[model samples]
Target: MIRQYDLVERVKSYYPAVDESLLNRAYVYAMKMHGSQKRASGDPYFSHPLEVAGILTDLKLDPATIVTALLHDTIEDTEATHEEIARLFGEEIAQLVDGVTKLTRLELTNEDSKQAENFRKLILAVAKDVRVLLVKLADRLHNMRTLEHIRKPESRRRIAQETMDLYAPLAGRMGMQGFRDQLEDLAFAELNPEARDAVKSRLDLKQEKSRDLVVRIADEIKRRLAAVGIEAWVSGRTKTAYSIWKKMERKSIALEQLSDIYGFRVVVDSVDDCYRALGILHGAWPMVPGRFKDYISTPKGNNYRSIHTTVVGPERERVEMQIRTLEMHEVDEFGVAAHWFYKDYVENGSKKSVSASDELVAPFRWLREVVEMLEHDATSEEFLEHTKLEMFQDQVFCFTPKGRLIALPRGATPIDFAYAVHTDIGDRCVGAMVNGRHMALRSELQNGDEVEIMATGQQVPPLSWDDIVVTGKARAAIRAHRRRAEREQYVRLGRGIVEASLRTEGLPVDEAALEVVVHDLPASTLESLFEQVGRATLNVETVVRAMLVHFTPEKKSRRPKIKGAKVAAGSERAREDGTLPRGRPDAIPITGAGVGTSVTLSPVSLPIPGDRIVGIMQPGKGVEVYRIDSPALAAYDDDLDCWIAVKWDIDADEHRQFPARIALVLANAPGVLGEVATVAGKHGANIENLTTTDRKPDVYEMTVDIGVESAQHLERLLTGLRGLKSVSSAKRVYG
Candidate 1:
């Protein structure tokens, strides 16, 4: 059992004026309540809450937040209720406890929902009151620190994955570099054990041999700063396990081949002193070329500011050096908590404001942006995949015409730039000028490009624009546009289907008729009906039948002539011939057409429904329903035939297993393939083949063809596939 005195003593140290009597009574109540409880590590359950409260104290949160931390698990795992908490404390304290309590009851069906919705809830709760997030971060930090005690391999993997995807990124967003680094190290230790061990062993060996040399270097730097009448502190340390893993992957170097396994930090008194120290250090050791960054001038999007330089030490061994002020160092390690720690100084006599530092504010903005992108009803897999991509990004600093810096992810193009500026700019973007020169909207932006967005009133977002956009923000906007367009199309189609039925029943079809039929239904129900029609769930026949029963037509309206054409037949010969053109191919003769009838724009590798698309067509492949784009046929524009008017194949006697695409985004490890194969078998999936391709650093993209009965089967299989520790996304291959 954890001693009650320790919790009270820690609280007293932070808040000498606090009421110790209340804390002692609450401690006694908690100890008795959790007396029989134990953790996965077999520690007393009371220890967890006490430790959580201690962490809250370390973070310098208010007393209410600390108390909430102590009682967070009580209502969830014990007999206590929100009312009970409110009765014991006040409403504000109970509310805080409730917020922290909500973080635990997450019901995630898939990994994506587990990540996106959970984090979405977490961040929005934090945004309301930042302290809730601070305490939760502390709680997660401790859980990660002791994750190894969890016996099950699957449980360990899930926790590690959750840490990397949710907690670590959150810590980074909050500017808590120390906690973020430790969480990442712990996660890497569990998820990629071999890489973690290799990096740890190599770093240990380097530290064993170079400890004396590093100490001497630090001593010399301290002496030099002292002689210059500048008081400072210097320290040398090996990189964390996660940092080492990233470096090896980034440089594509083996552990034994890694050169810079250590870093040296110099903490000074002011920003000027930081730069002065950097200059002094460079004078002592030759600076490495192209290894200097002055973040103080242009801070990271995460709001971290420092001056970094790499230099050659005594034996010409490369040593990375970071210089910052003591205040910067404090913020660097503790993030926003440092402000609370020094709140007394700032409030009474110190020369600073008590508000959050810019670093704290900046990360919240980015985190909110990410949360917005993820909360668009995106599937858990997609949300997790895209969020990971965005979070793991390396920023590129581009400039607007006004010389304002706009930081974006590396590989982000001008389209992403326009979207970043505003949704209106993205919708109206026609072209762009980079550095006063015309450039393609898809051109990758580089550092320091003074880009000017060129737009026309006639411009609109293209459905295929998402294929070229790299950022999650841009993609979310594009998806929103697509959803709107789809809804509009369904509304029009529903109107037409309703009108035709009313006309056949001798009733004049009008808005009044629609109102009568939909009188009892919500507006959303009408919208959903239209969507169902668009997706071929409720066909025109079904809509007509429903309308005929509801309305009577008054007069006949002239109907357009229906074209009569033979439905093209499909055969295995079509697959073998490969005559169905796709992907930038010239027009070819379609044998099914009448003599002298022309067929142009034969899409290669795309299945056109009416044209008897064989293996040449794919589910997602956009193929021409018609050979050309026409304004009157807006429904069929942009590979119209690719939008197959699919109906229920009621007469089909057999359930066919069509080839569906399964992509695995996994950590490239030795036994990962075997593990994935085992899981696939467990989930009743027959993998036809698997092909692997390397993506940037540690992750690989593998494609596998699997047989599935329908979309639901595929969803279940993909869900199982993603449950594998390393797999990122699993979905059908739609072109």
Candidate 2:
């Protein structure tokens, strides 16, 4: 364990202006608070915080961060209070300590929820001040180092998994590669010890066999750079065990097949010298094909900048190399800590401050994005899902038409790009062009591709966009819109059902009376009650029955005569022609004589030319509509009690698309699939999806989802398929 004075002296070395008395007070306070406690390793509990503080000192963080490391666990494990810490160290350090304390008191039901909630809190804390993350990372590092002493395999595994899943990635995102590698290796050992041990053994053997190869390559690189009049330092090392194993698994190759496991770094004095060193090295050796990335021109979101390349070197061995300036190297290793180091140096008047923007260099922007996501209403599971998608995927850089750069995760589509640009743009996007040509909205973006989104003020977001977009922001926005739309649809359906029920009971459709009754129910508003009924959570019949008990019926003689609902002109013409109405209506409008009341056409058997098809309200689900004799009606036998009467409006449009499923049995031979597709295409049917269920000696069963203009259009497609000699049978699947 590092002694108190030694730790203070280390911090003072980098930041001489740090308050020595504050450091002494924090050290003594933490030690006293944890006096009689012992860690799982059978050592003084204070030793853990002391070690964590020592780790932060190595990072050369600000004084408050080091102090935060010392007192992070006091409020959680001891009698120490936040008020006392504030009184002693001031509110900044106190808040930092409070933020670092693990969220253990949340009463979540499952372990996943609890873990997600804890992470959510940690992110919110880090968004306020990034040092909270720095200190928390150091605290976790010490715990991981001592994890083996816990003695409980399950506890150890859980901690290791959390570290691997959350903390390690966070460190990497902060550009702390050294910290990330250590955390990952330690966690990998506990999570999959056998695999880790195997990789380690292989690495050891390789290192032993290549004893002088790394040194020889480093020396040769140094010599080459010197010959070019470039002052540089070269170093080499074997990749970490976790990294090697991950690459092998990702590529599905054996350990021996890994060619770039040996890596070399060339550190130069300036950015210009870094590129100059790279040119010299590439000229000296044969470069591996497709093994170069120029991150210096376009740095990573974490601000990692280096020139990475693979080249055949001195011994004809394939080696990976990274070239960067000394400053970039420092940032790559220490991340945000390097900024503090530079800041401190500038304050001491020993060096000039770099011109990088603090916002671009800090990790808080990403942290704030996560914190903003929490403001939207999403389930714990959903929040975790989106956050993992945001944090874990590799990134691809794209460009706007005007050349502005936008970085997104791999497999992200234009929807994600639009959202990344602005929320309004995503909401208004109607189409997109990739590389100056129109493409599908779901087309995945590639690196360096320029995208131009076409927007329209009148367009609402497509319901299918939720699946096409991969980013959390786009998904959250899409889901929010869908939820609002669904609620509106439910409210409309519920109102129709209530009015139809009232009309059937010979009761007056009084909106005022219904509002009074709805106020007494579980719902807070009349619209909410209708929405509940439409979603089938509240049964329409139950609400009608409740209202009937509260309402008094008017005298029969005084009641006004209700007018008969009119059928659409097209339906009337079809009835006169003795033909059934086979086309779907653009809008299914309900009609009745009473204001705000819908009347159901009686003897609701099969839908006739004059009969209207309306939906039945189901709880949680919005509605289910089916024509009588349809296959879907069979499934609703159990929901017969919830059915309500509905009708089509006279002004309903004739042109509208509806989903239809068709199954076909085709001859299991060449050209049969194409023949069936041709038959459907000849009838103007758009095939959305196709799947084969079973294959026999002579026949195959297949299902296709087709979009049709109406029942008549679907029937025409079915007839065309039935006419094909290759199709054994074709029929509409209504369920």
Candidate 3:
């Protein structure tokens, strides 16, 4: 464990203006508060905080951060309170300590939910002052280093998983590659020891076989840079076991097939020298195709900048390397910890302190976005899942027409692009123009692609967008659009229910009673009260009961009735859910949020009279009806609140023909497709679309979309196709 004088002197070594007395007081206070408390490691609890402070000192953080690390666990684990910390240290250090402290007292049902809630709080705290994150990361790093001391295997695995899932990615996002690698490797060892051992054994065997390979590669790179008169320092090392295992899992390859396991980092004097050195290496070696990325020109959201490339070097090895300036390398390694930066453009190379610039604050913008998203800014249950996925996903940066950059996931579409721009833009998105040409809204975006959104107010979000969009924000926006659009219908329906209840009570329909009820119930306004009633989340008799106290008694023609709590549910009939042919004025409209047109069955989902169905709102196409069990509904699992609850109102629409698609594998003989078409036509099904692909010399695959009356008709057609001698396989397709 680090002693008091040593910790204080270490902070003063870099930050000379540090307060020695403050550090001494904090150290002693932490020690006194944690008296006789022992860690699972059987060490005094004070040693943990001491080690955390030592870790932060290596990062060269501010005095407040180092001091906050020393006392981070006090408010949570010991008798020391936030007020006491504030009284001893300043409010800044106290707040930092509070932010680093976890909310252990929350009554969450399970470990996962508790973990999510804790992470949510951590992000909010980090958003305020990044020093909180610095202190917390150091705290977690120390805990992970001593994780083996945790006796329970379950506890160890849980902590290790949390570190791998959240902390490691966060460190990488903040550009702390060194910290991220160490955290990941330690966590990987705990979580998957067998895989870790397997990777480590392979790495060791390779190292033993060619121990001097990395040294030779570094020397060759240094010599190549020097030949062009560019000064550089090249260092090489093998990747961590966790990193290699991750690559193996991602590429589905074994350790033997994996190339580019070794990496080199080249640090140069200036940006010009960095690029010049990159040119010299590429000119001397054959550059590997599709393996170059220029983060130097376009820095990451975390302000990470470097040029990464792979080349078949003089040793004929697939070697990966990164070229960056000394400053860039420092930021890449230390991230936000390196406070004083931007010495390049300053005259005479005098450094200026800028601890609160865009470079420092940009990475935390993601945390801010996350906080905004958690409050139903998007979907609720899937929000945490998407949040975790975003932490692990590599980002692809694209540009808007106005030159603003928008970063999204690798397979993100134009809809994802629109949402990344703004939620309103996503909701109103109609189409997009990629690189000055019209493209489909579901087009996958690539890095550096200039995209332009074509939006109109009349266009509400399409439910099909849930399938194509990859961002959580876009999914949330899509779900919110339907709920927002339903507010008016809910209000209207609720008003009728309220008026009916009033009529049953022999009272006149009046808005005056709503004011009393709104205050009496869980509603902020009369409209919300009506909305709750319409959605059945609030009972109508409850609304009337609140009004009875304030209502003036009028003459009643009928007095005796059933008890208020036991009103008959089947008696209430609004008849406003149908929209067939406009002949019946009392029919229920069955209208969805933005869907006013006639409902149509999707060609892909093929929902029929006998199948359970839902209405998914689509732009221009009304609510697209889909079967309840379709695979395409998987994306809408989080968006189910937006689905219009649908039921079969008729046996079948006589005039409507539902299109269903089916696939077939058949012997590629003379007339297989023609015979299949004839068989389908005989069953009263019309082939709307047919496409065939040659599978082999003697076999073929074909897809056909046919208009049928119901699932029965489609099933019959499939049966006939299977009976054919040439057809080997025939199956109906949904989704």
Preferred candidate (TM-score higher): 1 or 2: 2
What lDDT would candidate 3 get against the real structure?
0.75
Model 3 C-alpha lDDT per residue in residues 46-151, reported as the tens digit of each score: 9998998998888887777778888988999888888989998989788878877753333233367666666666666677777778777787788899999988
The order of the candidates by TM-score, greatest first, is 2, 3, 1
RMSD of each: 15.5, 7.1, 9.6
Better of 1 and 3 by TM-score: 3
Give the winner by TM-score: 2
Which of the two, 2 or 3, has more lDDT? 2
Clashing pairs in 2: 535-618, 535-619, 535-620, 536-618, 536-619, 537-619
lDDT of 1 by residue, 1-735 (tens): 336787777777867766777677667667777779999998888888888788777666656667777887887888888897788787877887788888777643335555666766766677666667777888888888788888998888887888887778867766788889988998999999998887788778878887687888778778988888879888888889888788778888887886776688889889989878887888889988988888788777777788989988756777888899887787678776665532334446656524452334666677667667755656555565566667778777888888777878899889889888887798888889998999988899987788999988866588778888888778877777766665565455445444544454456556655555553443346666555543444543455455557755455432221123321222132124422212111222222221111111232222222222211112222112331221223332243222322111211234445455667788877898888788777766678877775675788897787665445667777788788777777665542
The better-scoring model by TM-score among 2 and 3 is 2
Candidate 2 weakest ten by summed lDDT:
593-602
Tell me the deviation in Å of residue 22 in model 3. 1.5
Ranking by lDDT: 2, 3, 1
Tens digit of lDDT per residue, candidate 2, span 1-735? 898789989998988888899999999999999999999889999999999999998888878889988898899999999999999999978988887774333323338887777677767667677777788788889899999999989888888988888889889877888999999999999999999999999988988998999999999999999997998889999999999999999999999888888999999998899888888888999999988888888788777889999999889999899999988998899887676542435556577543222555645466667667776676666677777878778888999988898888899999999988987899899889999999899999998899999998866678789888999888877776666766676688677666656655555567787876876678888888888877778876677667778876453212111123332222343324422233211133543211021222222232322323544445576554445344444445454454443444432254434456789999999998788778777887778889998989999898887767656677778888888888879987643
Q: Could you estimate the TM-score for every candidate?
A: 0.73, 0.82, 0.76
